[model samples]
Target: MSVAKKLASQTAVYGVSSIVGRVLTYLLVPIYTGAFAAAEYGVVTGLYAYVSFLNVVFTYGMETTYFRFANRLGTDRRELYDRVLSLLLVSTAGLTALLMLLARPLLGLLEIPPGHEQYAVWVALILGLDALTAIPFARLRLENKARKFATIKLVGIVANVALNLFFIVLCPAVASGKWLPALQPLVTHLYDPTVGVGYVFLSNLFASALTLLLLWRELLDFRFRLNLAVLRPLLGYAYPLMLMGLAGMVNETLDRILLPKWLPDNFYPGQSSLTAVGIYGACYKLSIFMSLVIQAFRYAAEPFFFAQSTEKNSPATFAMILKWFTLCCAIIFVGISLNVEDFGQLFLRRPEYLQGLVVVPILLLANLFLGVYYNLSVWFKLTDRTYYGTYIGAGGAVLTIVLNFLLIPLLGYLGCAIATLACYFTMAILCWRLGERHFPVPYPALRLGLWLLLASGLVGLGWWVQLDGWWARHAWHAGLTVAFLVALYVVERPRTAAPLVVR
Candidate 1:
């Protein structure tokens, strides 16, 4: 098989774990929104925003560090894995204990209700378990155990979904009806309807615990070793990556965290801050189509980039991959944006939460930029200039904070969307410019710009042109989507001269 074909097959394998898993978990957005009020859902949204940041802290770049050492010349892969595993075990236990002990203070910082403090304990446990599992998962990837990697991920996601259904769906039915009267007391005792979003947290906790069982081999296989010789260099290589991950999380999730804190009373005087958070969070989930793509690409791209760095034609291959990645994202952006209502009907459960739908397209574009930035970021990682990643991510985080502070009060959730878009676009451009000076890939700038322009033009035309009937409107937008696809084909017509398989 050709190198390109092999790369694609591996990427597909990675996608099964990332894209499929995220889609399963993402399906819960509609269910949660439908079952709970916007305010109730907001509790889930806001708390998980903090989870994203804290997970970065708890994991502390051990996964990337593992990949780095395992791939390096003369490095003892087992020693490095065992050292990473040992370090994480210690750190995870300590962090979990600290967070649980200071639950009240942490809850207070988040403005969480006093009764909901159990959420803190649950989150701590979840983060700890997830952090402990990080190296195992990375080990699977490093060893080319993609099937095992995918199985574990799918198991977690499926377990989470099943648990969600049991707690959020069946428990409510058994509690309020006589259909399961024998188990009604048990259901009533375990599941409190008034607990609201706590079930979301509980489901996550249970699912994470279940995943640990599946990874027993990985967890138990490692020796307990944390040699200073290994630890020093690992930290040297990883600290900058940890900083990059933390700052990236800030840009990605700070809007959800800050939106409620900064929401103005005049915008919705009667509704609580959580209500605003719920709406924004639900709308943001609509951008998961883009997030899933970025995630799947990242999973496949990282190892591929590292392995290919030594090849003679690596730069040309990287450039080709970038263009193809751009094309995929452009197609996704156009498909999702032009067919916004189509997706809404499928996943958007509550009309109330759809108030922030305007942000969907904006956030899709933002996430696309974020994905492109990830592709550009290979230069820093490859050159051992990972600190440059820290700079770019930190700068984006600053822009994210400033923009959200200024815009959230004035524009509400829309401010959050705009801020995210600006942050990512600026970061992508900056990273590309910096990359040109350091470890450049000949990215087709004009071709990529035209692809984006075509998508934007289609979006604009769809918005401007009016159709009299609902059917007519969908038909028009659908036609525009087809036209975008055709434009893509025409632009890449030269490649199709030789069929992909030539069968």
Candidate 2:
């Protein structure tokens, strides 16, 4: 099979796992909105934003490190595995303890009330468990064990979703004497309706713990070797990736973090700023259409690019891949933007949560740029100039934070979306500029720009112009979507990429 075909097959398999798991887990959004108020949901969003940063912290870019070292690139696979596993075990334990100890101070840093201490501790535990498993998961990726990887991931998602239902839905029903009278008091103690978002955290904690248990095979299959010599170089390589990961998290999640504080309390008067956050968080899920696609692509692309780094004409290959990826992302952006309103059956159980839907298109576009940036990022990763990634990501993160600070007070959550779009756009541009100097990929910037503008304009037109009839308006927008797809085929059909064989 051709390399591109292999990549597609891998992406599809990974997508089945990630996209399916995400879709299943995604279904819980409505259940959550139904169970919790906007403010409660907002608090959940804020805590998870902090968790995203901590995940970056505890994992410390070891996934990328493992991939870089354990593969054909840097070190003996078994030796690299043991080195990373040993480091992770020590670090995970240390960080988990420290985070729990500093939970209150950490929450204070996040501008969260210290009363949310238990939540902070839970976040600490989740990140540590997840960090512990990072190298194991990367091992699966390196060995081309995509199916096994997907199974484990899907299993975790299933467990989390099941626990969520039991805690939020079934337990509530049982406690209320609506389903199981025998289990009423027990469930009443276990399930706190007013505790609201805590259940979401609890469910995740249990699921993560279970996943660690399931990963015992990878953890225990080989004896962990303590090689300080191997450790020093690995750290040297990974530290930059850690910085890049942290900065990337800020770019991706700072908006959710800042939205709560900067969005005024007056918007919902009696409620805290979390109400706006809840609305924004729920609306952001709409952009997961693009995020899921980007994630699945990354799952395949990261390994693909690493393996391909030694291949002949790889730059051209990366360039071709970027074009297709960009086109795919543009399709997703258009798909979500056109269907944002009608996707109500799949989104927002509470009508009040729909207030922030306008952010959907902006975020979809933002994620498109993010996907492109990821593709462009291959230059630094392959060249061992990962510090460049840190520079790029840090710049984007700073821009995201500053823009959110300035705009949130003025425009509410809309400002957050705008900031995100601008941040990713700037990052993509910078990555392209720097990448050209080091590992030039002949990415079709003009074509990509035209497609994005065309799709955005079509969607934007539909959004701005309120057609009188639902059927007529949707049909018109739907036609525009078809036109976009048709145009994509017409432009690219005649130009077939040569079968890629680098090894």
Candidate 3:
């Protein structure tokens, strides 16, 4: 099959699980925001942000290392897999143990209340499990077992959502005598009236453990062999990748972690910083449509690009893929930006949390650039110029830090959103420029740029033509999205659609 067709097929399969899973997972946003106070939700968000950062440290760049080594000609695939898996198992276990031992000091460092320290422990466990499972999950991708991969991922997400609903929504009512008495005790203890945010992490830990069991086939395939020679080269390749991953993650998540500390004292007086963080985090979930698409694309794109590295016209093929990815992502950006008023209603059930709606568009645009950067980054990977990626990512991390430092105190969470967008946009552009020097792909730069400009215009028009009432506003915004898509299609019909017609 053509690379495009293969990517489409795999992405569709992956998307089924990703989109549905994220949609289901998104249901928990309402549950969380409604169940927890803003401060409580902020604690949940900050702790998870910390978890995301630690995950990068625990995995230590092994997932991509697997891809790099597994695809190389001279390597023993099974031994490489075993070594990487064993390394991950040891590292993650050690990290988790270390965290457990120092849990008190860590909680003290973060200044979380005694009651909420358990939340940190729950997050640490979940991240450890996720880190350990990363290789097995990557093995499924390497083997092209998209069906099994999608199934396991979907099931984990579904289990997470189910648990959240049972604990936060159903159990409370049942325990409060609003429902049947028969099931009350089953979850009465589980549904802690005061432990609102803790259950989110607890549910995630349960789901991660459940997912490990579901992936037992992949996990049990592990062996205990160590290849010293393989380890040297793999480490060399992955060491920079580790830096890239760390810098990249810090760029993506530092805001969530630092916003509370950085915010001005009077921004939301008398409330805990956790509340501000929670509002930002919950509202950010609205941008997950863009995130889900980008993530699924990355999963398919990385393997697909690696497999196609030796093909004729591979650079051109990659360029085409980037163009299509940008176009589709731009469409999504417009769709969401135009209809954000409706989408914001999904999680911002309270008036206090509605302030976070401003960050939605900023985050959505940042994710778009992040996706483009991922696509552009193939040049370094294909040409063994991975150091460029590290450099670009480091630059982005610096930008993220500087912007958050400057703006967070002045503008609060909005500064974080702006800084994130700026960081990603800079990273994407840098990657593209550096990739041109290393392995130039004939990206449809002019056309893709035009598409972005046109979409921006349409979004601007939607804002200009403000309609009254929810139904009217939704209809108008939907119409704007459709019109923008049709215009984009018309402009690119010859290049994108004519060949299909001729075929």
Candidate 4:
């Protein structure tokens, strides 16, 4: 019970940043959807999709490697940190430079507008800064410095949001002499209207740089060690994780990348492929609510899991965690998917963006499965059979690529949503099965499946029963959601009567 409370408390602290910062950042979705055309927003979407893949390459699984080795007996914690950060610094430098050097050609390949060549360069810098800070942030997690981590994360996000509003909203208004006429001259000198959506990337770059600056103490502590004895083991363990991460990013972001290429012209009837990409991308932000929950849990759970690896009761504790995690995610899946119309109208400012709302529920459920997979993945990591993760992730990535290729032209972005769902569902099931053999946990699979089924059934019921008036329809959905909570309480109430512990 105490352990669970500790995990929950840490999750809450991390949630302060992940949930709050994401919601703050999520607000920008509306601004972008309203401010730019779907095609223009597609540029932002496509570029960031590429950045996700590059991010995996930049850090190359060193963060988790640091946590693993740092906790191992007889390992020099300071030496581990130094070697990890040193490798990351050297790799990030070379990768960012190479990215910048090939920026134009890369943009050309992606079919980015010619004048927007700077996007690639800005993206490289952002990735480099983020990669460099990964170890510092990991150290904070390992040290149980949740408050500091949350504070730094929130500060960076606030800065990003403020800058975005400044460059994208305030500057445009001022330069046009609509608001702050007195500042028009200065704004005109500073803001380039031609930059347009480029300001989004610029705001992020500035924010990343700010984040790196704030982690100066961590950077200053680096002692620049090149001990191959220490590094060889770290790299050996991490290279597989890097492969896993690259493949995971493919499962996560490749749809956005492929949708622009594989989506046939005029599939949406009068909308270009890029416009479809923008619409899909905007609606995809709807999944961030669930993603934020998973991310917060992960921020707390990863290190917590490592620390608990030696406990006799760890497997049972993990099983208990998975049960509750799935239940919460299931509720979120239903709540968000059922009210997706309201959410779409609220966050997606333009009507065209709403055309992709059909994908929201699909995506929300997909993310739920992804979260489950994250929980099941502890076995491989703890057992040091991380190659299993590489295999599982690669299988999912291959599936994502194939499904996107085959379905994008036919079903449009709906195909991408389906592919994501299938990929995650398969991965979660596979991980559970594989974990049973190596690191058996008595997971309540049947109960968890039933919970999901009940949630899915309620959503299906909400969709079936048509009611007039938006408020009345929402009332029915609320009633259904409440019923699920009631059922959940009835089932888990007795379990809570005693502290969950190993006998």
lDDT of 4 by residue, 1-503 (tens): 67889999999999999999999999999889889999999989989999989999999999999889988999889888998988888889999999999888888756886777799999999999999989999999999999999999999999999999999889988988889899988987889998989999999999999999998888898899777776898899999999999999999999998887887777888998889989999999999999999999999999999999999999888988998899899989988988888999999998999989989988999999999999999999999999999999999999999999999989999999999999999999999999989999988897788889899899889878869997899899899889988998888778865434332
| Candidate 3 lDDT by residue in tens digits, 271-320 | 66778888888888988999999888888888888989999889778887
**In model 4, where do residues sit more than 4 Å from their true spots?**
498-503
lDDT of 1 by residue, 263-332 (tens): 8875866678888888888889989988888877777778778888888878777777777888898888
Candidate 4 scores a C-alpha RMSD against the true structure in Å of 1.7
Question: What is the TM-score of candidate 1?
Answer: 0.96
lDDT at residue 68 of model 3 (Cα atoms): 78
Give the Å shift of residue 69 in candidate 1: 1.6
Q: In model 4, how large is the Cα lDDT of residue 475? A: 95
Could you report the Cα RMSD, in angstroms, for every candidate shown?
Answer: 2.8, 2.6, 2.6, 1.7
Worst 10 residues of 4 by lDDT: 494-503
Candidate 4: lDDT over CA atoms?
0.91
Models 1 onward score TM values of: 0.96, 0.95, 0.95, 0.98
Name every residue pair that clashes in candidate 2. Answer: none
In order, the Cα lDDT scores of the candidates are 0.85, 0.85, 0.83, 0.91
Where does model 3 exceed 4 Å of error? 189-191, 227-229, 269-271, 497-503
The clash count for each model shown is 0, 0, 3, 0
**How well does model 2 score by local distance difference test?**
0.85
Worst 10 residues of 2 by lDDT: 494-503
Model 2 Cα displacement at 308 (Å)? 0.8
